[model samples]
Each structure stands twice: as C-alpha cells, then as structure tokens.
Target: MNINIDIDFGNLWEALSAIGTIGAVIVSLWLARKDGKKKFQVVLKTTIGMRNDNSIDETPYLSIDAVNKSNIPLTIEEVGFINKRDGKKVTVTNQNFLIDGSNRLPTKTESYSLAMFVFNQEQLFKELQKKWPQGKKIRAYVRDSSGKHHFSKHYKI
Candidate 1:
C-alpha cells in the first residue's frame, strides 16, 4: 500500500511568520528588563601607607567605594564587609578614622561618581578576625537609600 500526504506551502509560510513574531516579542521583553534593572558598582581598596614629603608613614586602612553606574543618582546609606562563610557583617560607622571622611551617613553619590568609606586597617581587621577566626574571605557591600544592596567580589581577610 502507498500513502501520499499533501503539505500546503501557503500554510507553512504563515506558520513561519507566526514563529518570527513570537521571537521578536520575546527579544523586546528581554531588552526592557535589562534596561530597567539598576546598575551600581562597588570597589574595595587597601592603603597600607601614605607617602608625604619623602616620608612614607604607615596608615593602614580599608576603603569601600561605591560608584553609581546607572543614570539615576543614589545615596549610599551604609558600607561594610561581610564574611562570605557565615554571613557576618562588619559595619564601620565611626568616620573619625576615614581617610576622606563624610560628615554624615546616607551620602549622595551622583551618576558615574563614587562615595568612599574608610576604616582603620587594624581596627576593622581585629573585629573581623574576632568574629570569624577561621573564615578567610569577605565581600565588601554598599546599601543604597532605596535599601538596595550592592556587593563586590570576595577579598581575602
């Protein structure tokens, strides 16, 4: 026995058009989501010494800098480090020891600009060491005014 099935080219063209329309809709939605998401960058720096007039004095400190990479401006509410192992947070509130200290909290950081919080190296190190003696990794973080938390990659404690 022989069986012959007829396929219509017109119907096949319509089906392909439907698939293309669906794909275009999906790409549009994805791009919209990507554009709506917030973009904030965090950087960590350690200063072990300060050189002044042929003299390099020991000024060990850790600085957490948050830069607003998005078009909108955001205020940095807090900056700190968290132990990656146990989720322990160490917030540095006292600005007395900050290398470039701010007079108050929730400092405004404009787009493409940064706000830095500095902490005495020995002081922060001691506190973190006491909290997690065996933990060797930590991540720097900054909380924005809208309660959005932005974090950096792990750094060896």
Candidate 2:
C-alpha cells in the first residue's frame, strides 16, 4: 500500500511569517524593558551660597542637590566632590559635612539637599573656579533596593 500527501506552500509561508512577527515583537519588548532600566537615573547639582546669621555674621556653604529623576527609588550611598587633576575626593561619607545623612531618595518626584560648610568662602571659590576649568566634578553614588549601583553624571561645579 502507498500513502500520498499534499503540502500547501502558501499556508506554510503564512505560518512562518506569523511566527517571525511574533518573535520580533517579543524581542522588541524585551529590548524596550532593558532600555527602560537604563533610563532610571539620579541627577546631582552643586551651588555655592551665603547664609546670614544674626550674631555670627554670614556663612558661605556648598549645597548639593540630588534629584531622583527615575521611576524607581534610590538609596544614596555617597555624595562627594572630586578634584579631577589630583584624584582627590571630598566625600560626605565618614564626615560630619552632610546636613542630612539620610540615605533614602524617593522616586522621580522627590529631591534632597546636603550642605557642607565652607570655612573660607573666597578661598574655596577661587580654588573651585580654577579647578572648574580643569574638570572638577560633583559625584553622587546611589543604588537601588536591589543593590544595583547607579552613578550620576559627573557634574561640573
């Protein structure tokens, strides 16, 4: 006995095309999610300002502003100022400089400020001005609850 079968080429092509389309959609979605994770970030800004005191006169300070611009919350590990030329870092950690030592930073809509007192404002400003052209930077080191580290862009102060 002999068996005979017929294969429809057009239907096979259509099925293959549908499978390819589905696969492409799955890959695209996966890539999109991965890129979305990269978009979750924190931004840091630094400024020098003067605060007046009634009896002690005016004091100048450096203010560090950290903003969570991502969809997820972040735990700030360290905040610092770096002298690019000498590789010297002045960090808030292990020091009493930070006005608020709290570590948690809320998601996208929240911001935190850390203040460091400048003993001599004019001297500090002069040094910063010279170093600013040489790549002085403010750095914020942060991590997610999952312990994944995220570094903010090097902000030129």
Candidate 3:
C-alpha cells in the first residue's frame, strides 16, 4: 500500500488559528463578566457590628468570587460607595483587595469587604424605620474590568 500526503493544511491551519482567537475572546468576555459578578458578594449577613444612640460602627464582611472561565485570570479594578444625604448624593472612597479569578477566592477575600460609618447621615434608615421623615438613602456602585457599570443597588441600611 502506498501512503499519500496531498492535503493542503494551509487553510486548515488558518481556520484553526481563527477559531482559537474567537474562542479566546469568548472565554475572555465570560471571565470578565464572572469577575464583575464576584466583585461584591457578602460573606456574612449585612449587619452593623457596633452601634450606639449617637454613633455606629459599620463592619461589612464580604467574599468576592469570580470564575475566570477564560484561559487567563482577571484582576480587581476599583471599588466605591455612594450615599445620598439631605438631597445631595456623594461618592466615598472604599478600599479593595485582589480577587482570584479561580473558583477559589483568595485567602484575604475577607479583607476585600468595606464598611463605612455614618453618624446621623443615615437618615434614610431612620425614615424607613419611621424614626424620621423621608430622607436620604444609601447606595452601592460596582464597576467591572472594562470600566463599565455592572451593579447598582440601594440599601436602606
């Protein structure tokens, strides 16, 4: 039996190359979105660790989880908090830590959580509790790797 090798692998190589690139892109997008979703997940029940009649200490315990899904890993970009008080909405700087693109979050995942303290600025909570009239509310903003808005939710507390 004679062996023949007349196949033209040029097109085959090109097709494989193109498919690889597209697969990589789709995987990258999936990973990015996954990372975005894991940016702000709570590890513990939302609670104000310490508080007083005149003051309160807020401690936020959170665990950020992201599935790379891509052939590459993702990095945590930024974190911020927004508060609306007395008809004025302001943005506050919050610290952040790196989150692992792997299914297993980093060891310091607990540290990624951020807590803020507000004396009477949290009138919204009071108002909702009927302690005060309609007032300001607190909201959280979450951004993704692409600098695009991903998460925005208002919390009375």
Candidate 4:
C-alpha cells in the first residue's frame, strides 16, 4: 500500500505553538518555586537565634526595633511571643501593631510590650530561682513590617 497526503502547515504551526505555550508555563512554575524556597531560607536564617548570652537578669521585656531597609516606611502588622510555663507553652500577641517612620530610618520604640501574665513577668523569675534554682529557656520572636520574624540571641530566665 502507498499513501501520500499534503500536510497543513497552518495546523502544524498551531500544534507546535500549543506545545511551546505549555513548556513555557512549566518553566515559569519551576522558577517560581525555586525563588520561593530561597526566600524561606533567608527568613529562617535571620529568624532563629542561638542562646549564647544566658544572663538570667537580662530583662526579657518583649519589644520591637523596626528598620526601613526598603525605600518606604514599612508598617509592622503584628508582634507576638511564645513562652513556656509549667511544661506548657503559651502565646502572647498584639494585633494592633504598627511601626512608623520615614524611609532609610530605624525606629527604636517600646510600648506595653511586656507580657501581663503573672508567670512571664520578673516575679516568676525570682520564684524559679528560689525553687528550681536552675535555668529556664524561653523563646521570644518578633515580627517585622514584612512579617519576617527574628528571635533573640537567647537570654536566661
């Protein structure tokens, strides 16, 4: 058997174009994922901190220091902390968050940033010293204007 047929170049071109479009979308998704992963790494590294300075008296009053590295005044939308007491962890937060300043400026501000919990205050530290007389570890975190959080170079409790 012998068969001969003329190919429609217009149809062939359209098929190739569809394939090209699909390939482009796949590439775009891959690039976006890679970028997203890189961003997570940056934030993670800048967030977690080491407990090198273990001074018990280093007042752990939660506060925030905002630096406007971006070319505009960035506003922090939230700040919170997680603390452990009696083998249980608790979270404290302030939703009415705001960091105000101009571009290329750093704002050093502190308000009612302390935890009102009786256990998290300094009085508890004194009690711990009298009872356990051992070091207690509490992790603190601060969220910035961009919602990136960094922990303290840990202190003692």
Candidate 5:
C-alpha cells in the first residue's frame, strides 16, 4: 500500500502570514514594555533663601528639593554645590548643613526641603553676585534601592 501526501500552496501561504503577524505583535509588545520602564525617573531642584537666627543680619541658605516621578523609591546619597567655572565641588563640614528626608523616597511624590546648607553662605552669595566665572550650580547624587546611581541636571543659581 502507498500513501500520497497532498500539499496545498494557498494554505501554506496563509499559515506563514499568520506566523509573521504573531511575531510582529510579540516584538511590538516587548518594545513597549522596555520603554515603559524608563518612564520612572527622579527630578531635583535647588533654591536659595535667607535664614535668621534671632539676629539683625540674615544669612543665605541653600535648599534642595527632590521629586520622585518614578514608580520606585530613591535614596539621596549626597548633596553639594558645583562651581561651574572651575568645576569644583563644595560641601560644608559643619552641622548647619542638614539632610532631611527618608532614605527611601516614595514614588510620584515631592520631597520638599530635602537638604539645607547654612554654612558658607557669604561665599555663596559672593559667587552669585559676581559676574565673573559665570554661575554656580547645585548637584545632588542619588541612587535607587537597587544601588543604581542617578544624576540630575545641574540646577543653576
């Protein structure tokens, strides 16, 4: 006895097209998911204010604000100022510099007054007032819970 197998060209073409369409859909979905993860991000802002301690003179202070727009929490490791001209990092060793925030910054929330520095106020004021050397910037070094470091754009003052 002999068995004959029939090959249908039209059916084969239709099956191939279906497989291609399925593959394309899978690839599109994967790309969408990968891009979605990048939507989670953190933003930082800095400003200067005056603080007086029962004195006639007012002292300038630096305030940093951190906003978490991502779905996960972030940890702010260090905060300081950067002299844009010579690219120098400045940090006060005194107790006036305070870091106030949870180790884990929650998602989709703003942390106000996260850090404040009262030291070197006069020097900072002089830098801001001076025309030479351009301007100064605030820098905050942060990391995620997974220990992935994230940097914010330099906020010029």
Candidate 6:
C-alpha cells in the first residue's frame, strides 16, 4: 500500500499574509500607546521653622510643588489642597513664601524642573477648620494650564 500527500501552496500563502497583517497591526498599536502617554508628578512639602527672606517670618507654611518629570515642559496653573472629608477644593493665591519675586502662578516648568506655591500654614489650617472641624485629612494638588490635576498623598491638618 502507498500513501499520498497533498501540498496546498495557495492556502499556505493566504495564511502567511494573514499573519503578517496581524503583526503589523500589533506593532502600530504598541507604538501609538507608547507615544500617547504623558507623565506628571506632584510633591507636597511642609515647613514649620522660621523662614527668612527679606524679613524673618515666624509663621509656618505649606508648599505644593508641581514637578515635570516628562521630557517636555509643562505649565503650572494653580496649587492648593482638597478636603478629604467633604471633597471641598481650596485655591491658594496669596501670601507666597518666595522673596525673589519669581513665585508666580501659571508658570512654566522645564523638564525635570519643579514649580512650587507656598501658603501660610496657620491661615490655611484656620480656613479649613472653619468648614471641617476637629481637623481632617487633606491632599495637595497642582493644576496645569491644560486643566489637568495632579495630586499628592494625604496629610493631616
């Protein structure tokens, strides 16, 4: 008895074409995802010691820093905190800690650079306490010029 084998070159070519198309689609998708993602980070710092710039400021203050970790520059629009309990937002626009006159909002930050906003800690605490008594947890946030918000970890006030 003899066995017979059949080779279908047409079907083999069609299968190879389908595989190539699938691979091309996958590579395109991967590249698109990698290029479309944006990176942004925020850091919150608090200082209780006296600050001396022009005159000695004995009041404590809170600093919210917006850091540009991406390769591109980003603009910082505002920096403030949110009440964790009631979800209330507070925007700090006055009483900055910088004496060099460079601490302004809507500032541009270069790659690996940081833009910071400072506010009187006691003033902010009193304002927050008026709405949320007995203290509450708050998280710092920075809003970009594009209206995107970046947040930091929670801190008790």
- lDDT winner among the candidates? 1
Better of 2 and 3 by TM-score: 2
lDDT of 3: 0.40
| Candidate 5: Cα lDDT at 136 | 52
lDDT values, one for every candidate: 0.77, 0.48, 0.40, 0.39, 0.46, 0.73
TM-score, structure 1 vs. true: 0.76
lDDT of 1 by residue, 64-122 (tens): 77778877788887777887567788776766656645325778877788777777778
Cα lDDT of model 2 by residue, 113-152, tens digit: 3322222334445555654554456554444345554455
Residue pair clashes in candidate 4: none
- Candidate 4: Cα lDDT at 101: 23
TM-score of each: 0.76, 0.44, 0.29, 0.29, 0.41, 0.68
Name the Cα RMSD for model 4.
Answer: 11.2
Give candidate 2 misplaced runs (Cα > 4 Å): 1-24, 31-40, 48-64, 69-72, 81-91, 100-138
RMSD of each: 4.3, 7.2, 12.2, 11.2, 7.9, 5.8
Tens-place lDDT per residue, model 5, 68-96, is: 44443344444445454565555333334
lDDT over C-alpha atoms for residue 91 of model 4 = 30
Candidate 4 has its poorest 10 consecutive residues by lDDT at 38-47
Give every collision pair in model 1. Answer: none
Regions more than 4 Å wrong, model 1: 1-10, 48-57, 101-104
User: What lDDT does model 4 reach?
Assistant: 0.39
Q: Which digits, one per residue and each the tens of the lDDT, describe model 4 over residues 112-138?
A: 122111122454345435544346655
lDDT, model 5: 0.46
